[model samples]
Target: MSDNKKLSYCFDVDGANFTSAGEASVKVKKRLREAGFDPETIRRVSIAMYEGEINMVIHAGGGKAEVVIEEDRIVIILTDEGPGIADIDQAMQEGFSTAPDNIRSLGFGAGMGLPNMKRYTDEMVIDSRLGKGTKITMTVYV
Candidate 1:
């Protein structure tokens, strides 16, 4: 807390490895807990980050995440170079998912990733291009 300097963390989401999809979120939860964030705040941040990580794995093939802890908020940014989201509004719907049948069979791709991420975070913004990539930024107030 000295100097009002923010704490920041970065993680690489490896889409090719489903076994480690949520590792970054888990590490973040540990760090937040050690930093003395309240239980509820920790829960929200972890859930939102986990959801975003999953989306990056299943949809984008892989991505990067950055989490920054400031005096008033926890910010999570996810970036991926996969096939970009074609319709953000449609993707935001509770049950609208473009995940293939194979992914769904693994008990994922429930169409809840974006919705859950938005649900637990105080603010969320999505930047996407159909032929390029996607970037999602989420914030949870402290």
Candidate 2:
């Protein structure tokens, strides 16, 4: 790839399908590997993106995920139109989840999604509007 070139990828997450929740992250991991990124960097990106995708599926009912690969960093953006998080601070706390019982039964929604996302990424920003939606942007330095 050219030094000045930047690669961007987008995926539509299906909230209704729990089995396919991590597909986007898996694809991103494959792309990063193909691009010869270090394993640690790829792992960070994949874990962060996976948590964000799961959150989108569990909380937002579905959303869009966009990843941009740059020379110094990788950026992941998740946007959803479902009911927005009412409290950003609470949502960021570890072990804090609002997922329903059914979702919890599936071995997910243990309240670690947001915390794990933040842990894996170098930087994370969340913009949410109640009754509207949420937009999360995360960056992992290469």
Candidate 3:
């Protein structure tokens, strides 16, 4: 392949299935490895992406994710058209989750997703509007 330092991948998040929630992140991990990222960097990127992916599937019904690999960092952008987060601060808390009971029953919605995402990424930004949607951008240095 061409030696461009920039690479991108897009994925359509599916809400119909929880088992496949992390598919996009998994693919990203592999791609990052093929692109010669170190194991720690790959792990950090994958963890952040996977958490964002799971959140989208759980709360947004569905969404879209884009992963961009640049010379200095990996950027993950996740957007959804579902109900937006009401309180970003609360959502960012480690023990606060608004997921439905059904979702909680699945052993997820532990309220750690957002916090973990932020912890694993070098930078994270969330733009959301009540009743509109949410767009999360996260970056991890390589």
Candidate 4:
């Protein structure tokens, strides 16, 4: 692919199936590896994408994930139509999770989703509406 070309991938997250939560992220990892992305970049992209994928599964009841491979960076975008985040500020706090007891019992939803996503990426932007949905876009420079 040329530097001027952008390779994009899209996946529909199946929120109804917890077992398939990280499948999209895994695909992203494989794609990055095949594209010859550095290990560190691939790691960052994969982790961030995984966290977002889990969040969508546990909270949003499924969503959409998109990865765009650019010349110098990788961009991951997650969108959901489930109940939107009521408070982005509080949601970003580590360990502050609203996940139900059942989800926590499964060892998921520690509320580190947003924080970790921000930590692993160079830039993170969240666009959400309470009654509408949410859209998160994160970018990692290569």
Candidate lDDT (C-alpha), each: 0.94, 0.93, 0.92, 0.92
lDDT of 3 by residue, 13-69 (tens): 998889999999999999888988899999999999898989989999989999988
**Candidate 4: what lDDT?**
0.92
Model 4 lDDT tens row, 1-142: 7677899999999999988889999999998999999999999999999999889988888999999999898999999997899989999999999999888888887888889999999999999998788999999999
Angstrom error of the Cα, residue 75, model 1: value is 0.1
Mark the regions of model 3 whose C-alpha exceeds 4 Å error after superposition.
1-4
- Which residue pairs collide in model 4, if any? none
Per-residue error at 70 for model 1, in Å? Answer: 0.5
Give the range where candidate 2 is weakest over 10 consecutive residues by summed lDDT.
1-10
Q: What is the lDDT of candidate 3?
A: 0.92
In model 3, the worst 10-residue window by lDDT is 1-10
- Assess candidate 1 and give its lDDT: 0.94
Where does the lowest 10-residue lDDT sum fall in candidate 1?
1-10
Question: Which number leads on lDDT?
Answer: 1
The TM-score measured for candidate 4 stands at: 0.96
Clashes of each: 0, 0, 0, 0
Better by lDDT, candidate 4 or 1: 1
